[model samples]
Target chain A: MNTINQYYAGLDMGSVSIKAVIISNQKITGWALIPSGGNYKTAATTVMTQALAAAKIRREDLCGIGVTGLGAQSTPFDARPMSDISCQARGCHVFFPSARTLIDIGGQFTKTAKITDKGKIADFLMSEKCATGSGRFLQVISRILQVPIEEIGELSLTSQHPIKFSTNCAVFAESETISRIAEGAKPADILAGVHKAMASKVNMLLKRIKLAPDVVLTGGGGEDAGLAKAIGQIIGHPILVPPNPRLTAAFGAACLTMETTSG
Target chain B: MDTQSQVKTTAVKGTDTAREVRPMVKDIYKAAHEARENGKKVAYMMVASHYDEILRAMDIVPLPTENYAGLCAAKRDMDRFLLRAEADGYSQVLCSYARIGLGFDSLRKELGHIPEGSPDGGMPLPDMMIGSSAICDPRFKWYQATSRYLEAPTFSIDVVAPPPQADLNRVRDYYINYQKEQFQGLIEFCEKQTHTKMDKEKLWEAIRLGDKAWQLWYDIDRLRVAIPSPMPSQDHFSIMVAGHYYTGTQKAVDFYQKLYDEVKYKADNHIGVIKDEKYRILYGGGLPPWHTLWIFNYFESFGAVFAIENVYRGFDPVQVPSHVTDPVDFLAWRTWLRATAYHEKARQNSGNPTVEKLLGIIKDYAIDGVMFHACRSCRATTVGQTHIKTELGKYCDLPMMQLVSDMVDLRDYSEAQWKAQIGAFIDALEARTDQE
Candidate 1:
C-alpha cells in the first residue's frame, strides 16, 4: 500500500485549458485550472506549480506524475502520458463507482466511453473532425452571443421558448445565430437552441456505443447546466456531473500515478 | 515538474521482398508509357476488372488507373488532379481514386501530354478501357467517364458475389455460366481492340501461372498466423501489387515465391514484425489510407500489430485445379469462387458470412481487437461495417474502434486526431488484457 503522506500529480493539458490535480492517500489534495493560451508547456508548468502550492507541498515531495489530454505528449514534464479516455473513465469512477458510461465534451472534442467496473475504458467513440458535439461549440456561441461562457447555461435556462437550430455545423450555426438575433429572437432562446443542438450530436455518439447507466458527464462542457439539462432530457436519464467537472481527467491521472507506484 | 525524454518513434520495417516489389509499381506505369511509345495498345482498367490476363495475353499493357491514382496519393502529389476533378463538377463524395484518375485524364487531354509533376512519370493514355461490377457501382462509371477523355471505348464485366448465407450449391452453375460468358465477351472485345485473335495456349498458360501465384500468396498469408507474425499489413499492401495487377505473369509468381520463402523462414524462427508484440489487431475492412500508412507504425509504438485484415487479403483460394485445362473455364470458376468463398465458408458455420469470417480471423490470428477504418470516399467498404460491429458484439467482448478517413484523400485525415484516438484505443486494449 502507498504511504498516506506520499503525494502524486496528474495534469490534463487540454486544447482550451490546462488542469492539474495533486493527490495523497487516494484523496485529491489540491487542483488548479487555467486557460491554455498558445503555449501548452508553459501552461502545464504554471498549473502544476499552482496545484502544488495549493496542496502545501514542494515539487520534491511528489512520488509520480501522469499527464493526459491533447498536450500530454509535448509537455516538458516527468510524467507518463496516459490516454484521455482512460483518464476520464478513472476520474468518473472516483466520484461515481457505478458509472458504466462516461460522456466527456471537451473544448475541441467529444468522447463517449464504456467504463468497466474497475474504472478502465472498455470501448469508446469520439467525435471526428467536427466541433458540433464539443465545448468548442459552446465557446463559438458564447463569442457570438457576447456572453461569457460561464453565464451561457444559466441564461439559457431562463428562456421561455428555445429556437430550433436547423444545422448542426458550427460555422453554419454561427451565421444562423446571427440571423436569429436580427429576426428579434432572444439571446437566451438562441443559446438554448445551441445547447439542444450540441446535445443532439452527443446523443448520436452515445447511441452508437449503446449507452449504459449510471451515466456520468465530465469535461469543460459538463460545467454548462444548459447542455447537461438538454442531454439528460434527450437521453432520458439523469447525468451526474462531478465537482470541478473539468478536473476529472487530471484527477484520474493522479489516481493512476498512485496505482502504478503502489502496484 | 521535471523534464523527461521525448516520445520514442519506431518505423515499421517492411520486408525486403515487399520493398523490392514496390519499385516495380513505378515500372508498371513506365511500361505503359513505353508500350504506347512503341505503338503497342494499352487499356485503362479498374483493379477489379476481370480482363488483366486477357489484355496481357493480347500484348496490350494493362494500365491500372486506380493503382496509379493510389500511387499519386501515396506520393502526396494528387492535390492538383483532385482539384481539377472537383473544378470539373465531380463531387468530393465520389471515390477519390475516380476523382484523381478523372482529373489526371482531363488534365492530360488539356495539356496534350502528362501533367507536370505527375507521379511515376504519369500514366499513358489508353487505347481502350475495361471496368468491372464486382467492386462498387463507381467501378464501371469511373472508367466510362475516363473513356470520354481518351476517346476510347469501354467494356464492362459483371460479378455477382452473393451473401454468405445464400445457397451457393444451387446458384453456383448459373453464376459460373454467366461469368464464363462475361470472360468470353471480354476476350472478344480485346481481340477486336488489339486486332489479335485469342490464343488458347497463351491464355491457358496465364491461368496456370495465375493459379500458382494465388496459391503462393495464400500460403504466404497463412504464415501470418504464426506467433510473432512474420509480416505486417504494410508489407502486405506493397506486395499485393503483383497478385492484384500482374497475376498471370511469371514476374508476379516469382515475387510471391520469394515472399513466401522469406515469410516462412521468419515464421519458423519466431520472428515478429515488431520486437515486442503486445496486441494483435484485425483491420476488418476498408482500403488503407495511402498517404498516412505510417499510422500502422503509430500502432506499432504501442506494441500492437495489425496481424491480418479482410480487405486486401490473399486472393480467394485458387479455383484452378490440376484437371482444369481449359482457360475460359478456369477463369469462370475462379471468378465465381472469388465471389462466393466467404459466403460459402459462412454457410458452413451458419452466421453472417462477413462477421463469421471476422470472428474466425480473430480466433485464427489471435487478434485482441478490431479496427474498421471507414474511408469517407469509398462507400462499398464503409457501409455494412456498422452492422458488422454490432454483430461482433453479440459473440465477443473484444475492443473495436472505427476510424474515419479517405483512402486517397489526405484532407479527410487529421494526424493529431488519429493519434489521440489510437492512443486511447491502445489504452483500452491494455486495460482489457490486464483484466483478463
Candidate 2:
C-alpha cells in the first residue's frame, strides 16, 4: 500500500478552463486553474506542473492520476478518466457532508447531481442539446455588456429593478440584451436578467430530479453570488458554495485516484 | 448472395440472435425488393399491431414502417428525408420515424421512382396500411397520411386504453371481442384487396410459429438473468427487427431458436458479452438512437452491459400468452395484451407503467443501474419519465441517468453531453460496487 506521503493529481479539462489539484494524505496540497483557450492539452500540462510545483512534489512521487470534465478523454495524461458528476459529488462531499444535491454550471453544460450519503452519485441531469443554461450564456452576456465575466456576478447583485429577458436561448438572449441596452437599461439589471434566465433553466433541471437538501453549488458558475442568489430565490432555500468551486471536480478526481490506486 | 458475408458484426461481438437475425433482416429487405419487382401486393404496418401474421396469411409482403425508419437512421441518411418532410409542411416536432417515412414516401412520389440515396432503395410502396391506436397516436396518423398519398385502403385497429382501476379479467373479454371484429375486418379487407381468400389453416400455422418464436425469445430474455448477462442489449436491436417484422414466420422461430442456443451456450460457459463485466444496466423509455448504437460498444468498453431494453421485452411470452389454440382469439388477445401491458404493469407497481416495467426487469436481471432515453420526438414514451425516475428512487436506490436524444433525428443528439452523462453514471455505479 502507498504511504501517506504519496501524492496524487487530478485534472479537470472544462470547456472554459482547465483545473488541476494535487493531494497528499487526503488533503489538497496545491491547485491551479487556467483558461482552457481551446488548447486543453497545453492548459492541462501547465496547470499540473504549476500545481505540482506548489505542492513541492516530484512527478514520480505521484501514485495515480484522475481526469474529469470535457476534455478528460483526450487530455495527454496516463490517468483514469472519470465523469464530472462523480468527481463533483466526491469533491463536494469532502467539504459539505450534508450536501444531497450538487449543481454544476460549466461553460457549455449544466448538471444537477443527487449525491448519496457516501458521496456517490444517485442520479444526475445534464443540460441537453443547447448551451442556454450554462456558463457560456453568461460569457455572451458579458461580451455584450462589455463587463468582465468575473465581475458581472457582483454587478448583478446590485440590480434594484432587473428587466426580464424574453428568451432562454443564448443567441436570442444576446439580441434581446442588446435591445435592452439600447433602451437605456442598467448593466446590472441586464446581468441580473441573464442570471434570472439561467436560474429558470437550472430550476427546470433541478425539478426533474427533485432537489434534495442541502444543495451545494459548484463549477465555474457555482462561485457566482448572483446566480446562486437567483437559484436560492427560485428554490426557496439557501445553497452551500464551497471554497474554490472550480477546483472541486479536480480535487475529487485526485481523491478518486488515491482510492482507486490504494485498492 | 453469401448470407454470412452480408451480416455485419460489430467490433464488440453480439449474441447469436444478433448475428443470425441481422442476416435475416437483409434477406427480408431483399425479399421485399423481389416482391415489389414481381408485382406482389405489399402492406405497410406499424410494429405495435402484431399484424405481420395477418399480412403473411393473405400472402402479402409486410413492411414495418418504423423498422425502415430505423434503417435510414442507422445508415445516417435520415436528414435528407427529414428535411424533405419538413419542407412539405410536416412539423419538425412530429415523431422522427413518421417524418422519415412521410419524407421518403413524398420524395419518391415526386421523383416518380426510388431516389438513388434511398435506404434499401426505399421501402416498397404500400398497397394497404395497417395501423394501431395503442402505443402512439402519431403512428396511426402517419399511416393515414401514407394511405392517402398512396391512394390505398387503410385498416386501423382501435386499441383503447384500459379504464382506470380496470381489472384485466373483467375487461379482457370485451377487448378480445372488439379486437376479433377488427381482425375479421382486416381479413376481409385483405381478401378483397389481394383477390385471394383467407386461408384459416395457413393463418393458424403462422400464429403457432409466431407463438413458438415468442416463447424462444422469452427464454432468451430469461437467460440474461445470468451473471455477466450473456446477451448484449444492442443485439436486441437486430433480434427485435425479426420480432417486429417477421413474427408469424418459420424464419422468426428459426432465428430465435438459434439465438436462444447461442445465448444459452454463452451462459453455460460463463462467457459475458463484455469481459470483466462490472455493471449491468436496464435501458428504459423511448426508442434507442439507431444512429449511435455504438454507444453500447462504448459502454461495454467500460465493463458495462445493458442487460435489457424495455422495448425488446414488448412481445415477451409473459406479456402475451403462448398457448392459445385459436388463431383469431390469439391475435385478438395478443393485441389487447400488448396495448394494456404498460398500463396494467404500472397500475400493479403503483408507478408509471414504463418505469414499473423497467424496475421489474431490473430486479429480474440484477441490473446495477437504469438509463432512460428521453427521445425528443417520442412524447408518449418520454412523458412522465421524470415521475417514473423519482418513483423508481422510492423502490430502489439504483443510480439513474436520463439521456436526451431523438430516435431518428440525429440533430437532437449531443454526443459530448451523452458521453459525460453516461460516463458519470458508470462511474457512480462502479463506486457503489466498490463500496459494497
How far off is residue A37 in model 1, in Å?
1.6
lDDT of 2 by residue, B1-436 (tens): 1223232223354665576665666666677878878989888888757666878887898887888888877777788789998998989889998999888888888888876756666777778888877678887788788753567788887766575367878888887888888888888989989999988899988877877888888898899898878988888877887677887888888888888889999989899887788889888667887878888888888888988888655755644465776778778887777666677667767636656677778888998988888898887788877778788888887888888988889889887888898888887787678678
Chain A TM-score for predicted structure 2: 0.97
Once fitted onto the true fold, the runs of candidate 2 whose alpha carbons sit more than 4 angstroms away are A1-5, A26-29, A52-61, B1-11, B147-151, B167-173, B318-326, B341-352
Per-residue CA lDDT of model 1 for B274-384, tens digit only, reads: 899999999988888887787889898899998888887534575455676678888888777776666755666637778877888899999999999988989889988
Q: What is the lDDT of residue B374 in candidate 1?
A: 88
Q: Which stretches of candidate 1 lie over 4 Å from their true place?
A: B1-11, B164-166, B318-325, B344-351
Best by DockQ: 1
Q: Tell me the docking grade of candidate 2.
A: medium
Provide C-alpha RMSD values for all models, in order. 3.9, 3.5
TM-score of model number 2: 0.92
